[model samples]
Target: MDKIVLLPDLAKQDNFYQENYLLFLRRKLRAAKIPCQLYLINENTSDNESFVAINNLTDTYYLFDQILGINTLSNPLFLADLKIPTDLIPNFQDSRTDSVTFWQGEQRVLTVKLNKFGWVRQVVSYQSDCFIQDNYDVRGFKITTEYFDKYTSQVLKKEWFNNYGELIMTQQNSSIVIAANQRKRFRQATYNSELEIVKEFLLQHVDDKTLFIADTDPDTINLRLTLPEQFRFCFLITDSATVPVGQNIGRFHNIKYAFRTVSLRDDFLQIAPEVKQEDCQLITPVIEKANLSLSNKLVAKIIYWHTGEILPALIKDYLNQLLTIMSEQKDVELVIDATEVLQAVILQQLNLLIKDAGEKTKPAPINTPAVVNRVSCQTLAFQEEKKLMRQARIYLDTGTKSNFTLQLEALQAGIPQFARQSNGLITPEVNGDLVADNGALPEQLSLFLRSLDKWNNSVIENTRIIEQMKPSQVVEQWRELL
Candidate 1:
């Protein structure tokens, strides 16, 4: 079987709670029966077992820091073994198992944070709410510890360690104070940055059989140019932001690029005119095809606002438009898709708007339809968002920035999406609508709500759009590139 190594951007410790984009690509490739392996370039606190448990990755991944004989310990690092000061006792302030605090009678002294693997992540000592020392660990092994200035509470000194508990590196006042024998007893080479270290490791370890698929991060882009020409490389371009500027990709031998959409490829070509059209292929990650089934009654009109910055004024403007639509259409309801913080603000604004509108108009009689709060908040989780999209009469794109993920999700859910202007994700009358003016948005949405046949036609059109990016079609595209 052929091996394909995926070089994604640095993995964060909080990746377990967030949407891991790299994990999506890895799963899609594996689903196609491709032998895929993930390679990390950063020092994540989670060990192999803990990382795989959360990420659902198999036994085919490598971490550069771990492979370099740093933070290689698999055992749990107990806080008791460190022997905390006798004066300070454990204080169970919070119910969280991953965090703990130690108090010296009435004064808070020390705090310790742990990973899900029960490994001590950081030990911080505080004097009168000012940090004195901060010791950080990776995978149950101490890696770096920083001492702060007592009076200023600024980082004064930092000590770096190896797997063997050796203080091989230290820094003071933003400069290396004591550093030597960094690669002692393991590999002979010593590097300045982690990127250089990973680049060297790849050159030394990967064979000709290894097909490298790297995200278009700056380090990986540099690696693409610096690596030996004989090595085969393919870049996964997810959007226009990742496209390299002013570089002739066609000049590189045994190198190709895979884009998720034609709009992205067109954007890339505008910048890198020298890039050959043949060197790039449109290959979307697996998008689960949704059946075009309309709801018997349209109750919700979803507006996804996850990708861009959350502005209350903008959200208020969108809600005002929705409120207008709701006033005329009784069955339609507003469902906002945003984070928890944004949700609170949106709900507050919507309530205020509804209240103001009620105050302006005369009180309704008892016999009329009881006043109903039509505005509600929704989540952007996969299944929940898919459900909301399918049940929605129309998806309103209200954010300033274009959200490619939500666009794909709406298409996969067989929903009609309304955007301000047609971009790479939206085609005027095909997959979604383009209502440039806010005044026209309510009118367009109201039209769709009144005409079930028109809405069903839009949903059917979504199937045609999604057919080009289905899992089977994407797998075949990958097969051709590989």
Candidate 2:
């Protein structure tokens, strides 16, 4: 049987699967024994064309925005042919679980509760069309969809309520709507090589104090540089390889730029903020107090002790205290000592609290290589190794393995040795060049290190393992280069 699929409009400001309604539908389909593949649309392209192509592969394909009636395919069935069971249809009453209460300082402004089903109900009541406006308000509640769209904008529809618990008005043309509508024109500027067109576009529409680019496409980077000096631009660097060339060329434009590196595999986003000497001093006490003698894992546990107990405000206060200490003492050693002391103290406290909690915690798990047995090795060459290493440059028994060794040596010399993973098992079946310079190796290696760092940080942040250990554990773990 051909597979069933659900394709999301990646260009859609919000992820389609993130919607509770779609999630509900997915569960229902799975329960009905329907195999569904989720295709994430990444490129900025025609949605209808993409869906049609995807539909050609699957027996049945459901477009995420099918409910919006936006698909312009020649096949009408593609738009409204989902055979979802009637019983599986969302019941607003049952799904009404969200509650929101708005407050004006000490005074309660309004309160509302609703769900995706409830929003759908309101949409249906207003119009018979299945396509729901991005935002609509029902009763005293406002409903909105959150997603990063092609314009890299977040749009919302809000409903206002009076203090008397009555619906005041539903604002359809909100700021988000204006921003969303303007994105198309702004995007056009990216394609125009003329600097004046791009400059004019920024002058008219780039009003935000900070602009965040979800992906670092070349066009987006071009537009980013057009912004006046007053605005701050924060770009989400997905991969070092994808970083636009000449990023530093526009440095003279007086733009303030910040970067937040994201690792999709590890699910980590780290803000790369410019740190000052004073800021370093502020964090010194926390590090100094931390017990450096303990294993890195143990230290991590102590730092994250009681995990959720550390409130954002408390962390802020700790940072403020560090800053205060730095301002008081100009001595760099004092600042370093303070950081070490603070680190030790925080870890020690966590250790004590965790011990009292009566729960055993273990170190975070690391990736391990498969064991190589003599028998397994004999048959390794016979296995379907060809299918596994298609992208890898395979090297046959060419002269001395010394050439491959030299390539590895070159890779290590250029890239950090700690960044690459060592392949423990040597299989005679796989005869491919391990290192292939497809003109992207350097960029890929940089990305690998970044992703490795992100993965390590995530593990440390979430687990109690060698929490006490230094941040350099990631380097040590991947020390063996392949």
Candidate 3:
């Protein structure tokens, strides 16, 4: 097995060279059906985990160099000792070395050197003549200096290079003209477009079982929410400034709906008041209150900013609504940044309110206890019922137990399982008596029961003559039920 380790040259000044070179190399390698495993080195990579894993699986290593600082080879033990004549060595004043060298035992097979500013200055190889001849079909492109010169000169100006020694520029076509700044802008736009396409492709094909680690960079943060919902979990390490509140709210919406668990950074709460207000408004309907938490520190900060005055009515209403939803959803976790001191202060305030209420209600003992208003209670109940109905529908859609399977079979048979009730009787009349018996159950549950009963009867009737039935007849009957 062979391994191809691709490390981007982050120091490259030209974005075109940095982005396209790897793409071109990878494509050519893949087209040739080379048995190579490619790995990308990112800023977050702290150890040699990828290298060690690849080396364990393969004997040969091919490092794809883009003339970046080749500091990736930190271990000198991996390098081969090859003595080159001093005359062959390129001379430099105040020399600072940066290069990737490949070795097999004591033989130095290849060496690619770059200067301090990350420009390719030299390439040295000591391999046999047969080595170049055997790989000429793949390596022949390196000898075509004119091809690269022609292509690069069109997009890049010679003046862009820091030090031009022996470099020669091809004559620019005078007919078509482009300003320097315009060319730079065009290159940036093209780079961004290509990056987006690659990101989209990776998102579409990402394996569900693997872990995807993304940095808090603006580009990565923007791409995070586009991932598939089926991912088991997602952990994001982000800065408050990189992702705006509007974008955060949108991404949170996806996380709340798609992912089972999400760990948001503490800095996520550090947002502008206006942004916070907008976020609360947008997220209130979609997320349960139990899954939302307003940090007390954040609340106190806001209050302090407002000179300790009470919050605006809109914000107060949003908090109240959130509390109501949270009260109903006990399983969902909402960790607030409330300190022990704040909790104690809240408790003391509540005690004072209770004491005051008790003094006023002493004359009317019968009406002493607080009672919720009927309309508010009804509204809460309605919301709870709606949530339950939604859950029941989801369960019916995805459940796979025997009972659910039977219900699905009945549904396919054109039997209306989710029929409405009229005067305590199941309407559309298939197994009305059975449905009535299960009246204590929820509507969807009752429907499933009735549908299951119908399916059981069909199964029984079909099974009696199952042995006598032809294969086609059995399939037809099953298909009808399905």
Q: State which candidate has the highest lDDT.
A: 1
Model 1 lDDT per residue over 240-334, tens place: 56765426454677878887667678777787777788888876545565654355354444444342454777766666666666676666666
Report the alpha-carbon TM-score of model 3 versus the true structure: 0.23
Model 2, poorest ten-residue lDDT window?
366-375
How high is the lDDT of residue 330 in model 1?
A: 66
Give the clash total for candidate 2: 48
TM-score versus the correct structure, for each prediction: 0.71, 0.23, 0.23
Ranking by lDDT: 1, 3, 2
- lDDT minimum window of 10 residues, candidate 1: 363-372
lDDT tens per residue, model 2, 1-482: 23333333333221212232222333444555545445332221222233223433443322212211123233222102323333332322323444333344444332233343322112111122222222222222212322222243333234322222233223343321213323443344122233334345334423544333223445545555565555543333322344343234234232222221112211211222222211111000001111111212221111000111233434334322322322332321111112333445544433443354444342211100110000011112211222211211111111111222222221211212111112211111121122222333223222322243532332233223223322243223212110
Question: What are the clashing pairs of model 1?
Answer: none
On a 0 to 100 scale, what is the lDDT of residue 449 in model 3?
30
Model 3 over residues 334-425: C-alpha lDDT tens digits?
21212344334433433443465577743422211231010011111323322322222111111111122122222222222322211111
